[model samples]
Target: MSDIDLSEAVWWKSRQSAVNGNCVEVARLPGQKLAVRDSKDRSGPVLIFSGSEWAAFVAGVKGGDFDL
Candidate 1:
């Protein structure tokens, strides 16, 4: 579990999110990290990733690495 404080974190989801709100929200965190959580489960667990990790994930996404 992370010890980061997110009491004042501002979160946002992609503009392309579905109408049903089944999407994830992301927040910028301290020390170049990021926090991600399910939009439907605001009080649930959060996933944290480092800047490099997030960049790699974004690159992979743009490269269609996760394409079905």
Candidate 2:
């Protein structure tokens, strides 16, 4: 899918996020795309991803694929 306007997207951080505000916010874009941005920098850059890519990333997180 092509780029979609994100100016109206409502970003939300995980409920499990800590109080330090060191987290990312996620927004659901049109055409099943997802956008992620740093909570500490709301006006900063955003990383966009397709539905499948986001799903895989979520799966990885659930499976501890990125555990240190």
User: Lowest lDDT 10-mer window, candidate 1?
Assistant: 1-10
**TM-score of each prediction:** 0.94, 0.92
Instruction: For candidate 1, write residues 12-50 as lDDT tens digits.
Output: 999999989899999999999999999999999999999
Q: What is the TM-score of candidate 2?
A: 0.92
Which 10 consecutive positions of candidate 2 have the poorest summed lDDT? 1-10
The superposed Cα distance between candidate 1 and the true structure at residue 43, in angstroms, equals: 0.5
Candidate 2 has an lDDT of 0.92
Candidate 2 C-alpha error for residue 42, in Å: 0.6
The alpha-carbon deviation from the true structure for residue 13 of candidate 2, after best TM-score superposition, in angstroms, is 0.8
lDDT of 2 by residue, 1-68 (tens): 33578889999998999899999999998889899999999988899999999999999999999999
Task: Tell me the TM-score of model 1.
Answer: 0.94
